[model samples]
Target: MGIWLGALRRPLLRALPTALGVVLLNFALLQLVPGDAVDALVAEAGSATAETTALLRERYGLDQSSWHQLGDYLQHLLHLSLGYSPRYDMPVLDLLLARLPNTLLLMGAALVISLTLGVALGTVMATWARRWPDRLLSSLAFLMYSTPGFWVGLMAIVLFAVQLGWLPSGGDGTVGAELHGWERFTDTLRHAVLPACTLASFFVAVYARLTRAAILEVQTQDYVRTARAKGLHPVRVRLRHILRNALLPVTTVAGTHLGGLLGGAAVTETVFSWSGIGRLTLEAVQAREYRVLLGVLLLSSLLVIVANVLIDLLHARLDPRIRAT
Candidate 1:
């Protein structure tokens, strides 16, 4: 318990400054862009009088200097307020909270699929080593790793949704359906299938290759040789000795990949029209909603920080050497 708490404390300490830096960087970078939300609104409305444009800019604080805006934004952060989203005409916090679950769901599903399948495929590749099975699986992993995720999503929609009618093409769930309980669950899962698989494809390839290399490397260790010499069952030795240690690298890689998963979700959500933070982020970007964008960036940075902290704890738990250190 003490060890875990110590591990947790360290990351928590670092997260504050890291999150602040992210906010400042995102804010500064957005300021560099030529337009603001008012510009987008004016374009959408097709025209606005000079007075009307000035009033609109004043209304959203766009008329303020960048430094002034930054000070105000930081003030809002201190108050736990994400400020307003002119794009959605709501509080940025509210907008994000509403969409966060869908994004988390998509991310969770993709992570599970990728880790499970990647680890299994990698184990198979490692077990087969120089044989045809290893060669075949390695080729597949490379193909998947190289293929773009959006293209995979499009192909999936074409085959499964459009042509075969096996799944819905887009959106998080059925529109206007009065689904309840198990029925609703199944419907949601069905809708998720394509997007989840599409998102997981590249990651699955990555983890599979990683796990294969880790396992192969571990198999050559002195501990593994000793386990074999002790005449333990082949399966037991492989599982208990080789695979367990092999997972350390995989776990570390997975932790680092969580942030990438969120980034990928933006593309995936756009592709599938999932009502997640990722899609909201795209809308925010398009509308030049810097407040909303900053909120999202801050939240994302915090999430990654928290996730890596948890990963560190898990790593220590898995490897006694880490715990000792």
Candidate 2:
């Protein structure tokens, strides 16, 4: 337990500074943008009167200087206040939390699917080495890696939702119908299939390549050779020695990419019309909702930091050398 706690200390300490930087940078950059959220709301409502604008500005403290606003925002942060979303007319934290679960569900499913498929394909390619099967899988992985996520999502929707008339085109679940129990669960899964596949494809490609390379490298290690020399079964040597160490790198990549999947799937979310943070972010950007956008950025940065810390812990647990260090 002490060892695990020790392993986490440095990364957690580093995360504090990273999170502070994200907050400062996001706040300052958004301040530099041309207009405030009040201008957006007034324009949308077609009530651009000076009095109304002034009142809205005053209400949200937009009338303050940038430095004062920054101080206020930092104060709000200290109190766990994410400020209000002028567009939604609600607490920004609440708005973000409401949409967070959907995003987590989507990204989680995609990550699982991608890791499973990537590892399986990678294992096969490694086993095959230079065979036709390996070549074919490698080529396919490259294609998936190069293709844009949104385009893949669009194509999948066209083929599965429109062409085959299977699966809902987008959204978390069917909107009008009341569903319960297994039915609702299956409906959600059905809706998630296309978007999840679209988002997972690129990750799948990345992991497959990473896994293959890692395995190939691990296979040449002294321990692996020693295991083989001990008359262990080929499968046992491969699984217990080579594959285990190979997965260390794969795990690191997965952890790093998990952050990206969580917050950077804006294109896939938009293409699928999924009501995730990415989509909400898109909406916020279009409407110029600075507070909400900043809140999202802060949350995303925190998640990435948390993910990295967890990855370090996992690494310590998996590799004895890491714990010793």
* Residue pairs in candidate 2 whose N, alpha carbon or C atoms collide under 3 angstroms: none
The RMSD of every model to the true structure, in order and in angstroms, is 1.2, 1.4
Task: Give one digit per residue, the lDDT tens place, for model 2 in 86-148.
Answer: 789899999999999878878889989999999889999998989999999999999999998
Clashes of each: 0, 0
Please list the residue runs of candidate 2 whose C-alpha ends up more than 4 Å from where it truly belongs after superposition.
Answer: none
Model 1: how far residue 132 lies from native, Å: 0.4
lDDT (CA) per prediction: 0.91, 0.89
Give TM per candidate.
Answer: 0.97, 0.96
- Candidate 1: list runs displaced more than 4 Å: none
In model 2, how large is the Cα lDDT of residue 15?
A: 88
Clashing pairs in 1: none
lDDT of 1: 0.91
